[model samples]
Every structure is written in structure tokens, then in C-alpha cells.
Target: MVFKESFWTLSFDGAAAGGKGGTEIVLTRKSGEKLYLSYKLDFHCSNNEAEYEALIWGLIAAEKHSIKKIQIQGDSKLIVKQVSRQFVLKEPVLATYRTTIQRLLDKFQKFEIEHVPHSDNKFSDAFTTLGVRVDIPEEEVTIVIKKRTEPSIILENKDLPKDLREKILE
Candidate 1:
């Protein structure tokens, strides 16, 4: 399958506050077109988890767009190092995230991840911090929710909170 461009550039960032987190991704094509994605995670996650979610979600967006070669840029030094094989992931949760990211990246023909300073990644950082506040043009922004783990079946409908039960009903 011939692609329109030789490569795409993806910049990602994650932000966390009050035990909640958000992720943002910006994808730019060689032709100067751009796509923005942001996700609000319902589950509790650390800053590192947020970073991994950004990386993984960006890769998934690339795959969906039929992009084969890409450059990934992010502000998370630890995530960048682990993905680049420069550092080992000791935490079980992070290890799982790393594995998932690697699996998705394997689908690409060529991919490079680099750690950029936070200043260099201001666009994504702003979106992450804002969560879903600012709305981009409908064609440009994609919003999603990131659930790190599946919901447990152990909880019966009667045991779920009213709001959660209503969501399940939907």
C-alpha cells in the first residue's frame, strides 16, 4: 500500500492533577496537515501512566491513518528512554504499558521516539493541562477516554454507584 507521505511527525504529552490525568497528541504530515487528539482518563493513574497513554494513543492514531513511518516526540524522559531501550522499566504497570507500546510500534515500518524538553512541547502540554476545555475545529480534534484497565465483573449492578450504573445502562 503506497502512502501519500514518506513520514509523519507525532508529538505527545500527558498531564496529571488531583489524581486525574489527560493526554494529548499532535500528528503532522509532510504536507503540513495536522491532527490533534486528547483523552481524559477516568481511572486513577500516575504521571508516568499518563505519558505512556499519550505515546500509545498517538501510535494507534498513526496506525489508523495508514502511516508507516513516523517520528514520535514527547516530554516524558523516562518513557522516551524506556521506549528507546536506553532504560529498563521495573514497575509492573509500566512494563505492561511498554509492552503494549512496543507491540503497536512493531506495525510501523520505521519509527523513532525522542525526548524533547517541556518547553518544546508546549502545544500538547497546554491541551493536556486544559483537558477538554478548548475545542479545536471538528475536523482537527479527536477526543477520547482512556481506560487503563477493564471494569471488574465482580461488582453487581446493585453494588455500582448510581452514576456508574446509569453509564452501564447506556
Candidate 2:
């Protein structure tokens, strides 16, 4: 969805290993001319399962932020297209995930979905180890959990307008 006055901007990530999916979701909203939100989710499961799980958590996350309109970005093309109705899901497994995601999406006042290539998704990549992060209006904080990898959590205050630098500590 295109930004109008205020909209929620967020990314949902799901990674799979040994047929298990891991998920990380980041939610940001435009509040008082900047981006802020109430919550985020990062967890581990199966890749496909996490994909679906991310969408579920995404809906909850945006809802918690009081977001009426949303624009979601993800690396799963199949998930994007299936949810968008551009392509029909034929896989039995994907069909289930699609259904679950659709239920969460139905709760939104306005919603749009798109796919980003995996390489550009640093949030999900960094959350590969199953940790969660959350930011609320007037709150600067990070979710503390176990680490499974070396990726530093790039926690930023959504109220600030800034360019993202990949893997760099500034």
C-alpha cells in the first residue's frame, strides 16, 4: 500500500533449516511524521511454517501498534503471490500456510503485500537465531533472547528518519 498520511511499514522473515522454519517480523508505523510501532516478533520454527507464522505475528504486531493500513515486505515470492492472488497455491503445505496468513490479513483495515529478494533482508537475516525485538511510541528498547549466530540486532528507533547501513555499526 502506498503511504498517505500514516501507514505501517514492516518486514516479516522466515528461514528454514532441516525443514524447520525460523521467523522474524519487524513492524514500523508513521507516527507524528515518523516511524514507530508497538511490537515485533522473531522466532524459530520451519521455513514454510515460519513464513506463515510471520504473517500471523505481523497482523498482531500491526494491530498492537493501532495501524489501520499496512505495507508488508517479505523475501518469499510464493507467499507474496499466493496471498496477492497473483498465483494459485498448488502445494498442500503452502495451501495451509496461505490460509493461516489470509485469516490474519482479514483483520486489517487496509493491506498490501510484496516480496523482496533474500539478499536485501537483513532484519530477518540477523534474526536467524530466534530472537525478538519490539519498539513502541516513546520507547527505545530491544528484545533480549538467546543468540544462535553472529548477526547483531540492528535495533533502531522508528521515530527517526535515517538510511539503513547493512552490517555496519554506526
Candidate 3:
């Protein structure tokens, strides 16, 4: 089936356990083609951090695909609200995440993000759960496994002062 115009749907979910985490991103084109990406975080982070990470990566993927319009769905209400400016951000780290997301959002001509029930977001959630639990494989799989050594925000903003960078890394 074809959409009226070029549009895409992006869904993301994140799972973290015992200082490790994983993020799953599903990008679907208007033509019904889907791309799945999963990432293993090598750094320690909270579940919220993982959610932000998933979102950042998902946007990056969509930008790479040259998508101009997108519909974003996630189960994290906090992340969605924070990104939408409905919630006040209290954490510095997440503030950084929000900033990064804002910058990425500017690349798209149109985009909308909404919170969905966990059950409604099961596909991405299930993939994220599996990504967090499974060990990295030696061979290739249908979904290529990627490793994130640090937060994407940190990686993107290298010009920050050393002290602030250290604090954010902590």
C-alpha cells in the first residue's frame, strides 16, 4: 500500500538491566518497508536514559534514510512529554538528551511524537527486551547488532568543558 505522500513511522523502545541496556528502533516507510535496528549500550545508564538513547538513535536512523516527515511512537511518557515540552526537565543528563533530540527534530520537515500504551508498542518493546537479555553474537543476524560505547549526547557534544563532560559521564 502507498501513502498519500512520503511519510514514515518510527517506533522505539529501550530496556536496561544491571548496568547494561539495549534499544530497539523500527522505521517503516510509507511503502511498508521496515528497518529494524538494535543497539547494546556498553555504558551504565538508567531506564530513562536508555529510552532517550533509543529515541536519539531512532531519529538518527530516520535522518540517515532522508525521511522528511515521520510519526514517532514510544511507550515512555516521560520521554515523550519532556520532548514535547509538556514536562519540566530536572535532570541535567536528560536535559542534554532533550537538547540533542530537539536538534535532530529540526532536520525533519514534519514530525509528531506521541506516547502509546506498552501493549500498543509491543513490537519495539519485545525487541528491546530481547536485545538487553541476549549476548552479543559472533555471526550476523537478521538485525545487525550495534554497540554504543557512551551516550549519544556525549558523543555529539564534544566541545563541552572537561568538567561538565566529566560530570555528565559520571
Candidate 4:
């Protein structure tokens, strides 16, 4: 089944600070209805890793909604370039992230990712920063707040090589 009218605009940002990380996602439907999601990372990760997590979770939400076409915007140039294949991924963990993102992209009928400046991505960035600094109750805010215990890729790939799995799970 395909959703012909289900085109969406997705924007995401992630931040890691003081051994904690968080991600925020904004999903805008073609009708202009918006959904906000904020995730607190339970484990330590780099800023780049957190960025990838935001993108991954956004894609998952789009898929759940059966969105066939999407436009994705992010402030992480490295992540956007790597996912678009304009840049090479050197780190093993990042390679895994790219691979997982590619798999998710394939599920969509059409998708495009573009790099945006931080100033242009302030909404997600600001929420993500707040999400990292304090724990907000879902009932207290309109944004949906959730926690991620581990990387989505790690949970999906059970057959991963032992060494790679260990490194990513670290």
C-alpha cells in the first residue's frame, strides 16, 4: 500500500553534552499538521552520533505513518553529506549508521536530505538542547518525550559481527 497524499517535511537535531545526549524531531504533514518528538539518550555518544539518531528516529516515525515522499533537513553537514553519499564515512560506527539510514531510506518511495545552517534549524536544536539539560514530563509539554536505551541500528541488526556489535554497543 502506498500513501499518495502522505508527503511530509522532516527536520531533526541532536545534541550531546556532559555525558548525556538528546534528539528532537519535527514532522509536518502535507496538511500542515505538525508532530514534535523529543528523545533523551540513556547512554553517552558523540554529537555526530546523536545527529544520526535523530535522523533515524524521524525516518522511523515517517515510515510508521506510511509516508511515501519526504524532505529531510538537518544541521549536521557531515551526516547529510555522508547519507547523500557526497562524503565518505571513515569511522566504523558511522558506517553502521549510514547503512542503517540507507535501509530506512529504501523503504520510502522518494526522499531527499539537505544540509541547513544551525540558525535555520533552531526549533529542533533548541528543543534538543533542552531535552538534554532536563527531563520534561510528557503531560507538561505538547512535545512527545521519550527515551532511547540504545542505537536503533543495534536493536535491528541481531546478526551483526561480534566485534562490530561490541564496538557499537560500547
Q: Could you give the candidate ranking by lDDT, starting with the highest?
A: 3, 4, 1, 2
Give the per-residue lDDT digits (tens) of candidate 4, residues 1-170: 98456569999999999877999999998788998888888788889999999999899888887888999999999999999999998878898889899998999999989999998987778899988998655456443777766776784587887787655433
Of 1 and 4, the candidate ahead on lDDT is 4
- Which candidate has the highest TM-score of all? 3
Alpha-carbon shift of residue 126 in model 4 (angstroms) = 0.8
Candidate 2 segments exceeding 4 Å error: 1-5, 31-45, 129-170
lDDT of 3 at 88: 97
The candidate scoring highest on lDDT is 3
Ranking by TM-score: 3, 4, 1, 2
Q: RMSD (Cα, Å) of candidate 3? A: 5.3
Residue 61 in candidate 3, Cα distance off native in Å: 0.6
Q: lDDT of each model, Cα atoms only?
A: 0.75, 0.58, 0.86, 0.85
Question: What's the C-alpha lDDT at position 13 in model 4?
Answer: 95
Q: Of the pair 2 and 4, which is ahead by lDDT?
A: 4
Each model's backbone clash number: 0, 6, 0, 0
How does model 4 score by TM-score? 0.85
lDDT, candidate 2, 9-76, per-residue tens: 76877565654344577776556333322122223444555565666556665766677888898888
Winner on lDDT (1 vs 3): 3
